[model samples]
Target: MDHWDEVRMFLAVAEGGTVRAAAEALKVNHATIIRGVGRLEEKLNTKLFEKLATGYRLTDAGSDIVELAGQMATASSQIEARIFGRDQDVSGPLRFTLPISFATDLLMPTLTAFRANYPDIALEILSSGSVVNLGNREADVALRVVVGGASPPENLYGTELCEFHMGFYIARDLACSRSLTPAWLLGANEAVPTDWAPDAGIKMASVPIRFAEMRSQLEAVRAGMGISALPCFLGDADPLLARVPGGPVTHIGDIWLLTHGDTRRTKRVRLLCDDIRSAMQGFAGRLAGRFEGGASEFL
Candidate 1:
């Protein structure tokens, strides 16, 4: 039995939750995954997984080996990088993760400039909201927004990049033509606590829309669908949108830039981090929502 290949297949199946997903991630056919797992179980003389209608569930024996397999994968990657990774030119794959909104609204617009600056660095962006573990090399760096002033994981080393100020925003014409009411638009998955909205001075009216994403919410607000709380950097920059007067900072969060201790000083990683820091610095005022009145410099 080829232990390496067998363990690789097992790891993929365990991580992916289904043979089909494992096959897709590994770029192999479904049959290959099934056969590989079967051979692995045969070698161990134990049923590693229980086949069920929804998906394969790992048995006790399989569950116990997952951590070991993950360790092997990490070690193997490290060895390969140490031996053949071209460290001279700041050239390699750098996996970066951030919230979907940051990627879409902020980074996407300036990615071309980053690409032009660091042509050798292969940038892989993970936009899922799930936090990937930097300790395990799941990602090289992350830009995360956390509310209520919680600290990031102790294992990671980074700093708060900027204050993410939020404000109630509506279309310029909507504010000019009508009185603000409780027709608040919300992200489909967002939960506006029953008491929180009213406590924050937002009076609820009949809502016309529940959008699935922040970008959609922004568009709906632009089209005069409803008012929504949006990041100052996004809402303030748009000429067509205006902040609701007397609406205090709806939410205040900090944008954290983090990286594992292992890669913090890597040339490429450092360069990318610097670029992000500089970009945020340039928009510090807008991001912090600093203003004398309703829409002074922000508007």
Candidate 2:
């Protein structure tokens, strides 16, 4: 294997903590990852990882090497971003990231329009649950939710699309099932105000049904699992879901269409940003939860 490929394999393994995960991330077979890491360890003449039952734990030496490798990756990404930033043409690869739900629920039509207008841009939409660090060139552009009015990273520049809020929601049938005790269906981020359930004017259960992701949480709610704080666009639009009255409408965050400062001027990126901003204006009402909604009988 080439020198950088060896380093890349070792870096992937270190980041993923498991050979299978590294293989999946790199789109290579498990044997390839094992072989590359083995070759790297052989050349370095030291054991980089301690193979544990749980996963590969980095040795002290491995940690040091990983830090250097991370720096190398960052520098390489910066160089690539800078070169791509200077491109003036519309025809080129453009990768962007956003929440999978947001992409499907709110931005699909707008994204379709952008694709229609700029077919040569080679647009790539990355919604996989990955650390989409613009600094690392994981994606060239991003639709990020900056919570609590926080600013985007110093290295990023773009405009705020708008803020979307969440509402307490329950399935219509479940709400009608008066015998069933009320409960919370938690999504990925579990940090929530303790008083939210009480504020809903319902005697909710103390324990929540936890989900690894919001998508499954949404499905659980639809299947009459319990109440959950769902985005207004999602809960309001679903026929089987109904808003629970007497709860605070929590602001998730302002959605921002940002790009690394180095690549902000790239033709395709700028055009796509423009398209999103323009399209967002048309969706301001829906995104901000202007739909006429009926409340579920939660009390």
Per residue, candidate 1 scores C-alpha lDDT tens digits across 1-299 of 25776788899999999998987675455676788888899899999899999888999999998899899989877875785445546778898898887787677755668878888899998998678888999999898887777766645676677788887787777666555664688876665535334332445576456777787788888887767878887887777788766556755678888888677767788888888777766666777876434353222
Model 2 spans with C-alpha error above 4 angstroms: 1-86, 129-131, 188-193, 196-203, 293-299
Candidate 1: stretches off by over 4 Å: 1-88, 179-182, 188-204, 291-299
Candidate with best TM-score = 2
What lDDT does model 1 reach? 0.76
Give the TM-score of each candidate: 0.62, 0.65
> What C-alpha lDDT do the candidate models reach, one value each?
0.76, 0.78
- Compared with the true structure, what per-residue lDDT tens digits does model 2 show for residues 26-78? 65557777888898899999999999998899999898889888887787679
- Candidate 1: give the clashing pairs: 182-203, 182-205
